[model samples]
Target chain A: MLSLDHARTILDVVLKTGTEKGFKPLAAVVLDARGAMKAFAAQDGTSLKRGEIARGKADGALAMGLGSRAIAKMAAERPAFVAAATHAVGGSLVPVPGGVLILQGGEVVGAVGVSGDLSDNDEICAVAGIEAAGLKADTGA
Target chain B: MLSLDHARTILDVVLKTGTEKGFKPLAAVVLDARGAMKAFAAQDGTSLKRGEIARGKADGALAMGLGSRAIAKMAAERPAFVAAATHAVGGSLVPVPGGVLILQGGEVVGAVGVSGDLSDNDEICAVAGIEAAGLKADTGA
Candidate 1:
């Protein structure tokens, strides 16, 4: 089980990295192995919508057992399928580039999602945050 | 405005307090003033349903600008109105005792909800968590 401290570490690192990089204010979410939220934060200037977007990306990654970047590619290839899936799930799944799975000892432990910046930048922050937490970022399915 | 750090702090305190009290594993959700989820967690043994219930309770409290305990009383008094209201909101409102508003400087900033135990016990945990975060609980209308 991922501890709350570890989740907070991921969130803090993500926000700090975004600040250091001079990216736009961001929102980040950390979810445990069961796809339940463990921690979350939205920088002061982030829009209220950032929280939901970040959570959607993270939940999508966990549900698919793949990084959100991969899901984005799939969505691009089959828009109809992705749309149907999102609707079926009550709009929880978002095909985006900011979600990365957290892996420890070669096992999936949780996920981190960042939003409010460009999707690529958001993904980079999530990867950096996971690495800072001494965990691997599973960006590839 | 409630920051993500504050939400995480509240969630952490609630879980810790529950553990200290030897209560059942719980799921908790924290929502910002706009009713957007800021943080959430389901303890190791908590059922998935706990998360939804917790969120429902919090959403209900926020929607009514009152505590879940008061909403529960209202529901008990007027079942028809409560049912219609819940249905109108797509079932987001739960008239239960686990939701408590978070007040800072005498203003409602957010709310917290806990589930996975008796409703009373869940409310106690939520109140404890809010108080630990240096906020007051508004359980009364």
Candidate 2:
């Protein structure tokens, strides 16, 4: 189970890393293994849109049991399928680079999503957050 | 203007109220005036569905400028209209009873939604959360 404490820790790390890297203000979301939101936070300067985008990316990664980078690759190869999937999921999925699955003992424990920077930068922040939480991040497909 | 502090306070209140009432573990969502998620948390043992349902209810309330209870009534009266509205909003609307609009100084600041137990109980929790956050619950149509 992803504890609220862990979620907050992850959010803190994500935000701190983004700030240290001079990235844009960011929004981060942590979802438990069951795809339930454990915690969410958006920096003061971040746009409201970043919140939804971050959550969508995290939700997509959780639903597909893969990192958002992998999902993005799949989307690139199968635009039609990705479109259909977005429609099918009521527009919840966002195949992007910022969502990364959190692993513990070789099992998916949760996921973290970050937004408000370049896609790759957002992904790097998520990875940093997950690692800071003492969890493994599955950034690769 | 709903701040992150207010959103987290609201979520805490909702979860605490639900636990005190012996309700099932609840998931709660707080959305800013722009219909952006400000904070979200799902208590341990709650299903992931609760998270989505809570978010959907809050999103619906914000979009329609009405509480979820009012939306539910409207859905009952005009199912087709409600369906069309849901589709129009990309399926974010959930005409359910757990969503309540948050009012501050007679202005819509944000909204709160809870899910887990009976619909009425969920609504009650959301109201408690809003009130605990020193805001008014605008459940009236």
- The models' CA-based lDDT, in order, is 0.86, 0.87
Give me the candidate number with maximum DockQ. 2
Model 1 in CAPRI terms: which quality? acceptable
Residue ranges of candidate 1 with Cα displaced over 4 Å:
none
TM-score of chain B of each: 0.96, 0.96
Q: Pull out the clashing pairs in model 1.
A: none
> What DockQ results for candidate 1?
0.45
Q: A31-139, model 2: which lDDT tens digit per residue?
A: 8887777888877667858888998999888888889999899999998998898888789888989999999989999999888999899999999988888889997
Q: Candidate 2 falls in which docking quality class? A: medium
Off by over 4 Å in 2: A19-22, A34-36, A59-96, B75-84
